[model samples]
Target: MTLSAPPVPDNDLMRYLRERGSTRNFKTDPIPDAWLEALLAAGQRAPTSSNMQVYSIVVVKDAQTKQKLAEFAGNQKHIIDSPVFLALCADLNGPALACEMHGTSFHGQTFEKGLVAAIDASLVGMTISLAAGTMGLSTVMIGAMRNKPLEVAELLGLPPRVFVVFGLCVGWPKTSPIPKPRLPMPAVVHQERYDASRLPELVEQYNRELAQYYRDQNRETPDDAWTQVISDKYSKPARQHLRQHLNTLGFGLE
Candidate 1:
């Protein structure tokens, strides 16, 4: 049976969240400039560290540019199909400049500063996804933009102290996929003090749940255990060169 899309909630944020899923298939329909601007405004409202919004959003609408971006992101068709693609960047130039103007020491090149900026940028991207969903739009986040960070920076004409964190595709969805099941609350959430005794059991139960979820969708289930899936993915050091890339962008990972 084809998994049906969850029903839209009646003014319920939680329900909407429960129904939310990453949309890979996007229609070619154009999003109105007003709607796009509104969505961006909503993303801008996300909380920032120390009120220092250390993030930049590069909105891409040009077809050839989108195609090149798609190629850079492992040839994801969604990047090209979506009417809009927003490249979210962890930026330190603004902070550095601000500090310079105030005759203070700039710390934007530090590893810790880069981490914080990345967090801020990720938060804004998530906010944009949620905002777009609420407005009957669909979105998919692409972290593969980091596959060639330097090339991406060059394509976007980013100066030193700025790095692309991720890309977000936005537009009307061609089809709605069911939300993938997440680990049970007990497995992820903890009471005041951390508890780990039941972790093994909890993980096993969720593994079964996810396996059944995949079976229900008639998708080929390769790995049944969630732990196994994660282990296999992280077994090798992926993106190990990112440290050097960040260094080249003026971030001191020291």
Candidate 2:
């Protein structure tokens, strides 16, 4: 089957997005306060769940703290090398306090609300990364912070009802990796209803594309395809104990 021509980006913002890719190698150059503030402002403008804004960012600039976080995050050297490390958290403490002042009950203790906070934090994190990219900065989100959630919370001095969803390493890029290919448009985007009739074929094509990407980067190719990567990461439990940890942290999973 012939694929249609890819649409050209209509503007600089769209073009930037198309060119966006994660950068692991970072320069030690410090991002200016003004640029940081602007990037944050851009994140603040991101949509949230009913404007509840159930997220917070803890900026870690202390060398010792980054070192500790590097250890916590599976010894990813980039965590320590980046100029700024941000612990993006799902925060309900502020809303709970607000409810207290109003003599009202805060209703975000349920498991669904926990999910909401996670979603909110993730949305803001993406927004911040995009804003950073717009300013020629690079970012890599660290998912390994969940490896030791209780310790990370203790290290960051988070209050009850707040948990780090992930950490983000942001700085000037030493180099940019090629943008990874995604599943074909049809494989992901369905028109009016759900459809997967062509999924297998589309995914097979994607596997070839990704294999080529790996070969170009001189990286070891995983067997099978993206499905194998997904299965390998998720076959067993990646972080099976997080539910209990979240409960201990006051999320309660009610």
Candidate 3:
């Protein structure tokens, strides 16, 4: 039997999803407390692995703290300029506490547990971003939060087994940025099986598209913009000390 494709709904949510872009230039307008609470509530509604909810979100509004975080994140001024900075953290501390309450020693130092917590934090962070967008707020995910994980933990007063996986800068947009182009769908989405025969072609196509996008925005970029950027980023050993740092943060990753 041939199954028909489901009808696509053209709605506000769909428009929001399509139009959402990283907001680096933000207005200094404060996010209302009610909206902040709502955003947190939205994050809590995200699905968790085994309902463990092994994640925490540290909200930073203080200018001084945001400045420090900005420095830690390679001096990204958005963290300081945005009204709110959120450190989305992977937290094994709560699970450990639960084990202690049962008079059992926690043996979740394995790589799988570490992965679970990271995934939990990532899911919640994305949810919060989406929710914020719906409320006329824009956000940018700061992966550089991992650049100084130990420092971030100390600054946030995170207990052992807790580390910032990433951060989010949220506020009103000073100006909307053009949504960056993405790789062709087939390049990423595999059908019934994993196919990579078209990867090189797809990458070249994406490179041209991204280069044109940059040109449209009057931004200087290499001809093979996406490919060149990726090459430069990964050519060197990036985040070589992350494993050791995570270990120090109590994620054994064994």
Candidate 4:
């Protein structure tokens, strides 16, 4: 039994929830320019930190540009196949300029501020995905772009204080991605205080649920359960170096 795509969102709020699960396979269809503008505009409406809105997006449509981005994104085939690609960046240049124009110091440009900008960028990225989904399009976020941030920055001609948090692949999905299994609310959600006593049992149940979801859909991934997948991801020693690379790209850790 192939897991069905979550039902089409029936209402505005539920529509947002149902419109999740990224799609990679895309058809050879062209996205209309007007709708493309609207999707991006919707992202602008997403909430930001103190309305600072320290985020920017680089929309890529040219085949060569997309191909270069694909190479940076670990050469994901769908990236090259997709009709659009948007690289969301955490930007501080605008604020820096604002301060300069007002002849004021921007002392808040600290490590904490960088994190806030990145969070705002991530929010914008997801909002774009949701915006695309609402317009009958598909999206797949590519975090692999961080695998080579310096190269990506040079390609995008970014200035200092601007960092690409992640890249989002947008297009018409050839096939709907099945919903990934998630831990139940009881397991993930804690009531009044932080609770961990039930964690082991909850994780066990979630692992079982994940394994069966694959069998139900007749699909196969690298691992069957959440534990296995997460373990494998953290298993790599090179993962730790990602942050050092970010520091090299103009983000001050201090």
In candidate 4, what are the lDDT values of residues 1-254, reduced to their tens digit? 89989976578646645546778899868889998899888999999999999889998888988888888877898889988888999898878889999999875447888898899999998888887877778888888888788888888888878878898888888877677768888787899988888888888888888888887888674343788878877887754666776677667656
Highest TM-score against the true fold, candidate: 3
State model 2's lDDT.
Answer: 0.90
State in Å the error of residue 184, model 4: 1.0
Clashing pairs in 1: none
Which candidate order results from sorting by TM-score in descending order?
Answer: 3, 2, 1, 4
Candidate 2 residue lDDT tens string, 111-152: 889999999999999999988987789999999999989999
Off by over 4 Å in 1: 1-10, 223-225
**lDDT of each candidate versus the true structure:** 0.90, 0.90, 0.94, 0.82
lDDT for predicted candidate 4 compared with the true structure: 0.82
What does the lDDT read for residue 94 in candidate 3? 86
Best by lDDT: 3
Candidate 3 — worst ten consecutive residues by lDDT sum? 11-20
lDDT by residue (tens digit), candidate 1, 1-254: 99998985567557668798999999999999999999899999999999889999999999998999999999999999999999999998888989999999987667788888999999999999999998889999999999989999999889998889999999999877688888778877899989888888888888888888888988777556577779888897888888899899887777
**Candidate 3 C-alpha error for residue 8, in Å:** 1.0
Cα lDDT tens digits for candidate 3, 131-167: 9988889999999999988898899999889999999
